[model samples]
Target: MILANNLTKTYGNQIAVDQLNLDIPQGQFFGLIGPNGSGKTTSIHMLSTLLQATSGSITINGLDVTAHPQQVRRDIGLVFQESALDRMLSIEENLYFCAGLHGINKSAIKTRINSLLDLFELQSKKRASVGSLSGGMRRAVDIIRGVLHSPKVLFLDEPTVGLDLPSRRRIWRFIRNLIDDHKLTVVLTTHYLEEAAPCDNVAFIKLGKLVSEGSPEELIEQLGKTIVEVSGSNAEDYIKTLKLSAEDYMLDGRTLLIRVHKPQPNQVEQIQATLRDSADIISVRKSNLNDVFIWLSSKGQGTS
Candidate 1:
């Protein structure tokens, strides 16, 4: 239940976000992806009413973010890139503090704390200092604290950036479960491609512009043909011979991605015949959202 129309933000000469238009439905898991300086964070800040937009407009749950900041805050929960938990406080104390901040009464605070602790699996660690918890545990606590008020919309920025694989998976499962159980609306920002796979819809941004927005499958379908990745010697020669676009070049480890318009009639066989003894076909697979991202960001700018 979030909408943005031609959202733009600038700091002096640098335009952090430009003409971004987003429409996210209720109970949908939306993803915002881009490179380091692609303005994803700026967009989130504007949406959260933490930073004022330079132009354009935003509304959440039918209230204008700028004109009705307090109303928007009442309906949305935000989990930042950095952990905002109080390291000195115990897990229960931290959530209790957040609940109080949201004007939750003392009588309901205890119930909310217990429920959140159980949902986030922090019940046993309730009395433990936040500093004593691992990064993943801290992340879970951070998210729980943000949602202590049981907000309608959730904004998560890089939720699992630095955690180990298990921790990352834990958060993923937790998020998925929360969405299903609570019917929550989520707007998650991340650069990790694998992380984007589970999202209901994805928005790709680059150079302060939104390049594409759709389901991952819808975007991948736009990039025709199966992708054949070959590795080892003579990749450059094969690329040149095929006249592959410079933008198509992907230095993914040792493999080179070759995108053909029509991958039929034994396309892999012809590649095997062409490369012959020069190179080896490391992997052959259909196109994916990653491929679509590379192609779109490299070719030119796009719109929703």
Candidate 2:
């Protein structure tokens, strides 16, 4: 379990994370999402004890983070957005060095490494240099390094950023197996909203403040049942022609997203007819996590 109370970090006049509070239960997958400058990384660093907070308090497993940083580090694993494995070393060597840092015995480290490598189907590449592996393979090795010591909480900061669809799915399957088998608490931050859809709980932040927190379904439910995506020129003009309220739609430069709480028959037909000549594309779809993200991001300074 983890708890953060009024957590805040400031750089003189600029506040990176302001009054952030989180209560993440054990064995839960929690997501912290926002736009480019939304301070997600700052919050993660403070929670992980890598960066100190200006004010407020954080505790993990009933121990104060600031007061027991050494013990806290022992109980947590962090895989950064960047690769942490040394390019020159073999996968086995990288994991060996990391396990040794945690005071793991040589025999135990070898056994543990073997089991994890086998689980990920990387047993054959144990002796291969990290630099020789593909991006996805290297990322798998990084993940192995993070959990090699069997930490309680794992922080995955964009763990599947640039991987292809297949690679991303493979990585997630491995992550799910680990969480299910070990009951590991996972804290994730990623640009991909679809990935956050599987999380147990998710929180959206903007301008260093918490905007909303709930299950993916709960957040998406706030928007209506169906969403009409209208891709056309001068989208603002279409909204006026449609005679919709301000809250019923979101207008981007050339795309207009209209939220329909109650689906009336022929609504899409009517819109198509109205914009048959002006619109380039028109489609009706269900509300999703991306819509929730847009709804939140539109409130503040950024959009991811």
Candidate 3:
């Protein structure tokens, strides 16, 4: 339900986002990923109407975001990387305050607040001050506030940045349930690569340009089926002896990562035997989104 055409954003002479085009369908879990300073946040800010684009157009549910920003704001919710909650307010009070801002009916606000609290399992702590809650609990409250208005689209930027693994998983589970139950369209940008694996589609941004866009599976398939990582002082020499081409491997200091396309039984044993003597560490595992991201980002620097 979100579309952008030739979107661009700039600051002084530096372009933060350059000619990005995106089409996110309704109920889709879309992800925007890239390294730091790649303009992921700038793109989100423009799409969410927090920052104006330098050129091109963006639409949310067919309404032009730039031309009709106030109207577009009604259709989307944003959960920023930083917490937006008031530490001094009680959890219930925070919800009540946000409900007032959304113009919810006075009588209905209480019931809605209770329902959300129950869903997030924060009902027992409704009266506790936000400052008294743990980091995970506070982040959960931030999410609750963002969706309190029941907007059709939700924009989450680094939603799980500082949380522990369990908290991160809990947050994602809540997001998934929100999408399934409410048919919510989610646009996410995160540093954690594993989190993007569940996305319906993901786009990589670099140097303010769109480098690649595809399903997680499609992107990973481009790098082959498995990644064999060998680390040792003689790793480069070992790879050279194997006659592996530059395209088939990546050199990261002491570690050499080799892509093995559809590795056969004999090939696996052969690779192990070859590395056993020279490598200090050898690991063979399924390729993942992180590998695709690294390959694309490094490769895109010269081309994009």
For candidate 2, write residues 59-111 as lDDT tens digits. 98788999999899999999898998999999999998998889897797788
Candidate 1 has what TM-score? 0.91
RMSD in order of candidates = 2.4, 2.8, 2.5
Q: By TM-score, is 1 or 2 better?
A: 1
Which window of ten consecutive residues has the lowest lDDT sum in model 2? 295-304
Residues 156-220 of candidate 1 have per-residue lDDT tens digits of 99988888887788778877887899888999997678888888999989988988888887767
Error of 2 at 95 (Å): 0.6
Cα lDDT tens digits for candidate 3, 43-108:
999999999999989999999998999899888999997888899999988888888877786678
lDDT of each: 0.83, 0.88, 0.88
Looking at candidate 1, the ten consecutive residues that score lowest on lDDT are 295-304
Lowest lDDT 10-mer window, candidate 3? 295-304
